[model samples]
Target: MWLEQMLAAAGRSGAFYEGKRRAGQYFLRYELPRTEAQFALLESLDRTTLDMPADCI
Candidate 1:
């Protein structure tokens, strides 16, 4: 699944770690669904970009 892939990528980059540190929650919210654009963004995201937070990256 795409979410699984995203989570794995986040794990590798430490973005998930940072998010957990700040939010006391998972790196991503479960309720808000991803759009097609968001999936495209994920596909296009490279290593350096993946190091940033999910909101603006």
Candidate 2:
């Protein structure tokens, strides 16, 4: 469910688009935060799985 929500947000943001192929693989590209504190928070959040997936936001 979280993955689905993330994908939807990404699609809305134009960060991901439907590819020519109809397979399971979807195309996605986006800019990530570039600060130490941000990276650390991301890492910690990822480890804990407390927040939604990266694309969810």
Candidate 3:
């Protein structure tokens, strides 16, 4: 969202150019892959807090 806002501020709305493209490439190559691993870890969890309440802590 911040990136989109920055692009819009620069009149590049909904378009990824140069640095934006590089940022997206970096995310896809690095950060995006972490999501699958994180999700796998979460999926392996035993639902320990499925019914937990927000204020419980």
| Estimated TM-score for each candidate | 0.22, 0.21, 0.47
lDDT, candidate 2, 15-56, per-residue tens: 243322212233222223245578787777565454559887
16-57, model 1: which lDDT tens digit per residue?
655544453333454244566678877885567557788875
The global Cα lDDT (0 to 1) of model 2 is 0.45
RMSD, model 3, all Cα superposed? 6.7
Tell me the lDDT of candidate 3. Answer: 0.66
For each candidate, the alpha-carbon lDDT, in order, equals 0.54, 0.45, 0.66
Model 1 is weakest, by summed lDDT over 10 consecutive residues, at 22-31
Candidate 3 wrongly placed segments (more than 4 Å) = 1-16, 47-57
Could you tell me which residue pairs clash in candidate 3? none
Which candidate number would show the highest lDDT if scored against the true structure?
3
Top TM-score prediction, candidate number: 3
All predictions: root-mean-square deviation over Cα?
15.1, 14.3, 6.7
The superposed Cα distance between candidate 1 and the true structure at residue 5, in angstroms, equals 25
In lDDT terms, how accurate is model 1? Answer: 0.54
What lDDT tens digits, residue by residue, belong to model 3 across residues 1-57? 535634545645454455675675677688877899879978898676776887896
Question: Which pairs clash (backbone N, Cα, C closer than 3 Å) in model 1?
Answer: none
